[model samples]
Structure formats: C-alpha cells, structure tokens
Target: MEQVQQRLTELGFSTGGVDGGYGRKTVEAVQAFQATYQLEITGQVDESTWGMLFGSHEGQDIAADDPADAPTADRLVELCLHQVNDRYVLGTQADHNNPDEDEFDCAELISWACARLGVEFPSYSVSQIDASHHAGLGLSVSDAATTRGALLFRRAGHNGSKYNHVAISLGTGEETIEAMDSKHGVAVGEIGHRFTDGGYIPGIQYH
Candidate 1:
C-alpha cells in the first residue's frame, strides 16, 4: 500500500498520507488516477490500474501528469495554515507524520505541506522554486495578482536570488502564510511588495 501511495504521488496524485494503509485517501487517489487514464474508476488498484501506473503496457501513449489545476493545491494551502502559530526554526523540516513536531522555516513549511500529501519538494526556498521550474513542475506567474494557491517569493539583496524566501498565497492579492524567519515562526501575513515573484507550485496549482 505504501508503494502504491508513493507511485501515485510520483504520478501527481496525492494520497494525503504515505502510511502503508489502504484507507479512503488511497482510494480517492486511485480513483483519480484511473479516471485520468480513462480506466474504470473502481478506486481500487486492480490489474489494469496497476498496469497503467507502473508503465507495464507497451503500446500505451501516456504523458506525464500535470497537476496544474489539481484540487490538492488548496489542501496544501490548508496544511500550511494549520501551522500558523508554530515557531520558526532554521534548517529544520516539518514532520507531516507527527503533529507534535511543528517547527518550520520559510521553505520548510512548503516542504512539509508537500510531504503530508506524499509530494516531493526541496527544503530551501531557492532550490524548491528554481529546481521545480527547471524541471517543468513549477510555473511562474509574473503577471496579474497571484490567484488562489499561488506561491509567493522574495529576495533580500538587490542582486539576490528571486527565491530568497517563499510563502503560500491565500489567492487573495494580499494574504499569505509563511515562516518569516526567527522573528515570526509561522504566521499569517501579507505578501508585501517585496514578494516580487510568484509560482504555481508542483502538485499544487498552476496559477
């Protein structure tokens, strides 16, 4: 079951948890996968579904999964919101499996949200934003106000990395959630003018 969950995640379907358990979340992910491939939506990993997922069928014409408008993006935002009051801790990754361990940093919060849904993400702002864009898993939104679920980013120095820090936009033009360094652990704040760039996060949304 854990393997299935991981496979689904790799295909851009979020199972919500990677625990080796066949619960409703797993079923939902399976259903989405099946539906995507025009297979029977049994919500169960039967022979055909398994074949589609693992690439066992030779004559199939398949493309990589695009999570541009997946519903899971909103959920990822919700997961970040749940950590609103947590303390900021640098070089620490948020533990999705343990609610009690809530320490996080700017990039760590995004990493944790992805981990909760079995999605893979880097632990630093620069890497997470840049690497994904290079891999075609992330899309930039430099025009128009960032829509709901868009990723917000900023840089400190004039010649600094555009992804110096990261935040989750509330879809609203102003609101966002992020671990604003040592001073503000995890807090609900505005995506001030400093946040000059935006992105559609992988496994989240496109814009």
Candidate 2:
C-alpha cells in the first residue's frame, strides 16, 4: 500500500505524505487518479488501477496524444443527440456497464455518449469539487456561451438542495440534450437558462 501511495503521489495525486496509511486523503487521491485515467473511481487501488499506475515505466501519459484513448468531441455530441428520446431510468442502465439499455439519466446519458464515441468518461455523476473529473477529457470552458459538443455540469446545492446534473451541448442557441427526468426521458431544452450553477467543460475534440 505504501508503494501504491508513493506511485499515486508521483503521478500528481498527493496522498498526504504517504506513510503507508490508507486514510481519507489517500482514498481521495486514488479517486482523483481514477477519475483522471477514466478508471473506476472506487477509491481503493484495484487490480486495474494498480496495473496502470505501476505498469508505465517512464510515466503515465495523461494526454490525448495516446491514440488508444483519444476522444472525438464532434462525434460524441452527434451521437448524444441521436438518442434524444430514449427512456430515462434512475440507478440503472445507460452506461458502459449496460450499453444495450434504452433508459438513461443525466450522468448515464453522458456515459452512453462517451461509449458510442469510444471515449472514456465516468458513468456516474461527477461533482464539481472532484479534481481530475475532467482530466485529459478536454479543456475547461467558463462561459455560458460555449461551442458545440461542450460537456455541461450542474453543481450540487441548487435551490438549497444537493442535486447534480450533466448534459451535452446541442449548439442550438442555448439548448442542451439530456436525459432530464422520468417525465422527460431525453430531450433538448435551455439548460443554461434554467440552471444557475452550471459551467462548460470543452469537448475532447474540437472539430
């Protein structure tokens, strides 16, 4: 565990001094690393995470130049909008885990898009405070007036409630395509106009 903690720190995730202690900081660092590498954010160093961390001799390549993990933003957005009217189900379906299911939620919708585009993304809702959530995925956009294919996130604590949401930009003025809710399975609407705690994360590919 010390070796793993050391490797994590060397990979740019600080494990709070790494004294062979798998404390909260260590877990958070591991989760951050997993988020960056598009791995399962289990917070525990699983076999897959361990392999990636120690397998690379030189260093982990967290850039898009690694052709094996490149994401095409245009293709992702195109695919996301293609399934605009699927079913919306909570806690099930619509991720790499269940690719065949038609039902989806907000986070699931984004994950489905990533799968179709051959890109890696967390299938669950990603928190804004979570570092590395968008690492290597693309650039970060701060403006509401963003380009097409931009990934949007709704931070927690809206209207005095902790509810997070995600959606894909449709480039239709200010509209976005998302698996909104049970009532609106999947549809396009003015997400920016409705949500105040929203921001844009640029797509992996520009063209």
The TM-score of candidate 1 is 0.58
CA-lDDT, candidates in order: 0.66, 0.60
Off by over 4 Å in 2: 1-70, 95-100, 127-145, 196-203
**Model 2 clashes, total count:** 0
Backbone clashes in model 1, listed as residue pairs: 88-185, 148-171
Model 1 agreement with the true structure over 135-167: per-residue lDDT tens digits? 664534433134655677775563454337888
Give the per-residue lDDT of model 2 (tens digit) for 60-148. Answer: 54443535545765455544544544677876665465544567888877777777656555676664313224443433433332556
RMSD of 1: 12.7
Question: Cα RMSD to native, each candidate?
Answer: 12.7, 16.8
